[model samples]
Target: MALNDESLQELKAELLDELVKEVPSKTLLSLRLAETRSADIGEILEEMIEDDEELPAALSLLDILSAERAANVLGYLPGESQLEVVGKLDDSQVLKLLEEMGSDERADLFNLLSEDRREALLRRMAHREREDLKRLASYEEGTAGAIMTSDYVSIASGMTVSQAMMRVRQTAPDAETVYQLYILDSDGQLIGTMSLRQLMVARPGAIVDDIMIKDVISTRVDDAQEDVARIVAKYDLLALPVIDVDDRMVGIVTHDDAMDVAESEATEDFHKGMSIGQLEDGVSRVRLWSLYRKRVTWLVLLVFANLFSGAGIAYFEETIAAQVALVFFYRY
Candidate 1:
């Protein structure tokens, strides 16, 4: 079952009780967190890190988890929180966590590091992983490539159903979603797509090209992330394939990631509607001065606008004097 807000709060309270002990028991902490979800864990960590007194406990809690689990939970943290966690870890330790993260998320965390730290980490990484990180990080922010993950399953054209099934089994472990698969040619260009259900029901000896849908709906790498989210929602796709200028399959923007973009965009629009500037963090976590700065500009302008009303009223003083009842009606 999904955890509601109350349950999350309860979990955070219990964890905090354990974390604040003089010498927290690692074994007990591990068992307590064993069944918790990554997103939930991230939320708890965010709360802990937001308090200066509990920062050490938060770091200790992260250290107790295995590297892969830590990386998974770290992906759910906001940018500021993510940096705070990474700031406490050494270069090698941070690299280990980065290795376990998904391609897109890894690139994001890498991009957040300072120039010297990024150079240090990049130097220690393997050739292939390093190249992939640089390529993924090279994309402009707010673009499709920036949010897309290279971890997707792709079947080659002309492969038999039996062969394709075997490939799926091999790659699905790392893929963002195996429900939708792209079919590519020898030149590494996407030519078609097929659902996992379609492949399962087809004859083992049949060619994938014969069964795959030739006309695939896809987006370009340089497209706006907002447009990508719209396309995902419009077609109700589980994942949208992203291609480069050469028509080569680069990565995919999973539905969850696209929805994140949509929600963020909606929040930004809401802020604009209220005449508030974009906030870098959630309202509760944002600094008081930042909140004031975002609000004061619009408020000052509206104050000036209200002064015009007083000027008009002054000009109509004689008219109001003739009709005394109209003075009260001006409040409307």
Candidate 2:
């Protein structure tokens, strides 16, 4: 059943009280609780900004909301206020939030932060998490690897279906999708693949090596993200396996990540064709002059190119006048 407005408000209030009093700040609970809209809670939290010690609490409140919501609220705040909130988050918290965020969304946020802030956040993250983010960030903005998550399920091919199922139960919580399982050889080479349905119906003692499909559709790490999307859409797949140079399963790109890649690629192409570079969401929070500076570089280059086109048109004016009567014939 849907939660009534009054019930949501009461829950929000209880959550807010807990956020203000709980140890370690009940970060996850606050995030889950604020999933329901509570404008009054937002307003109350906004008012606490005036209190010096309340900054952490206010930032925590914003962090608990969805990333898009946080981006929207941050956009509405003044530059100083926005920075104050972002500044309070440590690198680990920022990394956790980014990990939860969609690829384009995370890139947009990363673009907004200063280099020092970005470096600090990366330094604070765990080594594996940091490498994952760096490898993702390194891909061209429109590529598949840039948006794909490293979270996925993989098991050794020698394992029986029952053994794999046990591993899935233990690891599913951290995986982005568990509908498909990737089978890897002993050297961590991706050898085959299996679906949850197949795994479920297979004999408990049957080895994955015997039942898994060896001819799995996969994409290389360097493959264009657009190609990845086309493959997934064409196959109607829930997830696409990602492999490295050695043919090892590095990660799986889930359906949600594929959708985000398509959307981001579309947006970037639109902006580029219009002679505007990609605009990150945080740009809205920056100063008007700064925003103009970001855009004017592209506009200036386009203007100069247009000027050359005008010159060429002027040079052709005499020829056009001489051939004025030819215009109607040309039209035909």
Instruction: List clash counts for every candidate, in order.
Output: 0, 1
Per-candidate TM equals 0.92, 0.61
Worst 10 residues of 2 by lDDT: 71-80
Reference-based TM-score, model 2: 0.61
Q: After superposing candidate 1, which stretches have Cα over 4 Å from the reference?
A: 4-6, 20-23, 284-289, 317-332
Predicted structure with the largest lDDT when compared to the true one:
1
Q: List pairs with backbone clashes in candidate 1.
A: none
Error of 1 at 150 (Å): 0.2
lDDT of model 1, residue 129: 93
Candidate 2 ranges beyond 4 A from true positions: 1-60, 63-85, 91-141, 271-332
Best TM-score among the predictions, by candidate number = 1
Q: lDDT at 117 for candidate 2?
A: 88
